[model samples]
Target: MKYLAALVIALAAVPATARPQLAITFDDLPAHGPLPAGTTRLAVAQAVIDALKAARVGEVYGFVNGFLTERAPDLPVLELWRAAGLPVGNHGWSHLRLDDVGAAAATVDLDRNEPLVATLAGKTQWHWFRFPFLAEGNDPAMRLAFRHELATRGYRIAGVTMSFGDYLWNPAYARCVAKGDTAAIARLETSYLADAAETATAARTDARSAYGRDTPYVLLMHIGAFDARMLPRLLAQYRRDGFAFTTLAKAESDPVYAADVDPSLPPAASLRERLQAMGKAPAPRTDYAVELATVCT
Candidate 1:
């Protein structure tokens, strides 16, 4: 019994170098949330770029919703991301949720964004498609149709392994900044980092439970003011957890990410959801309402 106890302690002491890997990805690029007081799109993008560079993250994938460009024609925000060494992908033209618009409409949306992506990304590959709202469709048939279309079109589905309700905090942060609520802003920052840490832990737990080992994680974040603000600290948390950042392409290349897809299967929007779909228990939910209610209505 003492030998077994010693073995357990030894295992516990083993370093996290054997822990799962992770890749950072951003959606709703060029812009995401309403700008906080005294912030511009350029500033937000620059903050994100600088944070990633400082962390030594080699590449990040930014999925774009082309419609935003129609509003701000002069910024060349996609070019900024490309120039900074991030690749762009299609998140549809208007960020259509497939379940709402159907596969046919989603196809149109994808096509509408392609020319702009081609122009912006230049020779860089831009074949990833992240489902808007992570909803493929409510109908199995439509879901299969969409998946088949994506396969034939040579687009890989960008799966999300980790996310918190980071999007929820953006507008709240913007409101806090607008009102000069320094205390509220501090609370927002603390809660956001906590949420990120919790979700990253969840991703590690769920991946092991589902796959019998760690899988390379694809973390989903948006390009927003608060996300930019929290990014450096967030990356530091991952570093402490023994994660080494890589690109989305490299993460997806892991064999564990090659989990078989059943076209008829319902939407497995996230890694946790995918595990649940396979009848496994994922990490217990991380509640976002507690954080959002503190600052946002």
Candidate 2:
């Protein structure tokens, strides 16, 4: 009885395993990259929306670049996305890199995107700002200034914690589809899923290293044709890997996202950022860029 009581106490003292949480967010909506043959921008949007709906994911945010809607054909993608009960946030007007343009120009660019976002977002929270190319700024002072600017504008920075360069596959997939290369497309699918799974494992491992637990992750993706085609399988794989889908707002509500949820806080919202500040190096990720670039050519 004494031994059994001690065993029970020891078991109770061990913490329960933390289930990984993720918020899937899409960028470069209305249009992302070259569409596959026979695919329209609206069709890509519809496919992505269908996948999300089928998966029963909630409140996924599609970050919008208003410049794309200047072309009439691309406008309906936003309409279809909104009609499907998804939310839209700003990704800047021209998708300009803030580091390339100075803070003043980037601020103007961000504001230019607001009118369209405000119209489409309606009553939803449309003040989430995702930096184009995830480039906050090259300069520390500039980054801090831009963050303050975001806070003043009542915007939360949408920080990306998980990504496997999903955008890299879109152009290759398009090339493969154009050439009618089913074998190459199959290769793309395999590589895409492999990278996603590998990156998710790396992200969780890095999170544990930085925070001693897995913080809720916000996944960065683009609404490209390949992404639309693969989202259902991608989401299912995450589920199998023990990730529970969450809203961006809910994921950012975790304390690790304090800087992202409120830009007034000092920047430490990402594992890499935290590790860098701690004088430790973040784990290196496999770059598929070269392989993806040359695959279908």
> In lDDT terms, which candidate is top?
2
Task: Report every candidate's CA lDDT.
Answer: 0.79, 0.88
All candidates: TM-score: 0.87, 0.92
lDDT of 2: 0.88
Alpha-carbon runs more than 4 Å astray in model 1: 1-17, 73-75, 259-280, 293-297
Collision pairs in model 1:
none
Candidate 2 per-residue lDDT, tens place, 1-297, comes to 554354335434534346788999999988998988797998888889999999999899999999999889999989898988899999999999988988888899989999999999999999999999998887888888888889999999898999999999999999999899999999999999999999999998887777667778899999999998999999999999999999999888766666687888667535676688778777777888999999879
lDDT by residue (tens digit), candidate 1, 7-37: 3464344343465678888999778888987
lDDT of 2 at 83: 88
Number of backbone collisions per candidate:
0, 0
In model 2, the runs with Cα more than 4 Å from the true position are 1-17, 276-281
TM-score of 2: 0.92
